[model samples]
Target: MSFAPEELLACALARLIVARPTAHVAVGAASPVPAAACWLAVKRGAPIRLSLLHKRSGNPFTEGSRELFDLTGQGRVDLFFLGGGQIDGQANLNLIGTGEWPGREVRFPGSFGSAFMYMMAGRTILFREEHSPRVLVERVAHVSAPGVSEPGVFRRGHAQALVTGKCVFAFDPARGRFILESVHPGETVESVRAATGFGFDVAAGVGETPAPTEGELALLRGPVRDEMLETYPEFCGRVFGRRAAA
Candidate 1:
C-alpha cells in the first residue's frame, strides 16, 4: 500500500511533530497534511490546538479552536506548520503574490494570518506539498512574514523545522539562517539543491526523516478528525477535500 506525495508528506510531518517535545500547538490551514499532523500530536498527548475563522462573520477564529488563539497571545504556542509559494534561505516566506512585477504575477490567498502568528509563535514547521525549484526559491518577491530578521526588529521568533518532500531543514538561531537537517528516504542533497536557486548550509550528516508509526496514523484518524468535524466546518472541508484528492 503506497501513499501519494501529499499523504507521504503529511505522515512525515506527523513524525516530526512527535519528535519535538516543545511543540504544544500545530498551526496551519485546513490542508490535509498539516491538519493530520496537528491532530496526531494532540492524540499523542501533546496539548495540540487548532485555528479557524468564521466564513461569514470574518471574526478571528471565534469558535473552531480557541486554544490556539489564546496560546498565541499568551506566548504559549511553540510549534506551527505552514506552507508558502516562495521561501528564502533565511526561511522567510512569501505567499502574497506571484512576484512577476510586484503586482503582476498572480495574486494569492492572503497571507492567512501568518504575519500575526509568526510574530508570536515561538517555533514553526514549514512544509511544501510539492518539491520543485520554483516552489523552493532563493528569494521571495514579497515578504509575507519575516522568518529571521535582525534583533529588536518585529520578527524574532524562529521557524524551527522545514519539512519538504525531499528533505527537512533546521534554522540556526544565531544567524537566523537555515541548515539542512534531514532528507527523506530515497532523496539526495544534490537533487534537493537542484530545486533551489540560492545556496543554503547543509549539516555535516543529514539523515532521513523518519516514517510515521501506526500510532501516529491512528491518532490522526481518531480524535483529531472527530474534533474538527464537531468544531470547524471550513477546516473540515479543506482537510477532507485534500485527503480525498490524495
Candidate 2:
C-alpha cells in the first residue's frame, strides 16, 4: 500500500520507537509525526504510555508543563521529540536561529524547554522534516543545547538519532558525531551527503529505510486518523481524510 511522504516518515519514526526500549512517550503539540508514531505503537500492542499535550482525551497532565517537566526530570518519561531551526554534526540545536546572538537576522521561536528536556528525558529524538543543508548545518550559530555536554554537566541523556525527510542519522556521543543509518526510498547516499552540511560516518551496509507495512498503513489510514482527529483535525484532513471531504 502507498503512503504519503509524511505518513512514511511517521512510520519510519514509529520503527525507531520500537528500536529503542522505551516505556513512556511524551509528544509536543506541533509534532504530528511523533504523535502518530506513539499511537501506532499502542495499536501494535507495545504497551506504552503516551502523553500528548494537546489530546482531547487521555491527556495525563491535569494542568500544564510542570507535571511534564517533573516526570522527565525524574526519568519517568522514556523518550521525547525535539526539533530545531538548525542542527549540526555535533547535534547542537539552535532554536534561537542563525546569525549573531542578542539578535538574529532570522529568529525561530525561542527555545521552549528544549535545553532541559533534551538532557532530562531518557532519550531525545531530533526530528526535522526539512533535511537540506540550510537547516542541517556544519554548525549552529548558537547552541541552545549541545548534544554532548561538557564533563560534570548534569545531563541524564541526549539525542539518539535524527530522523529527517531523507534519512535517519544515529548520533554517537563518544565520537561526537552522527552516523548515517538509513536512507529513505528514492534518496541516495550521495544525495543525502550533498544535502547535509555536516560531515557524518556512513555505515558500510547502509540500507533503505523500510516502507510502512500494509498493517501500519491500514491503521494510519483508518483508526489512527480518527484518534488524531481530536487534536489534529487539519493534519488528519490533509493526510488521512475525515469523512472523505478532501
Strongest candidate by lDDT: 2
lDDT of 2 by residue, 97-123 (tens): 777884368888888888888999998
Candidate 1 minimal-lDDT segment of 10 residues: 51-60
Each model's lDDT comes to: 0.67, 0.87
Off by over 4 Å in 2: 242-246
lDDT of 2 at 74: 93
Candidate 1 per-residue lDDT, tens place, 1-246, comes to 333454456667766676766535645563556766666656667655444432234433544665466667677777676778787777778878775645477876768878777777777788776778777777878888887767677653677777777888877767767788777778888887887665789999887776655565445445666655644566555654456455
Pairs clashing within candidate 2: none
lDDT of 2 at 4: 86
Query: Candidate 2: minimum summed lDDT over ten consecutive residues — where?
Result: 237-246
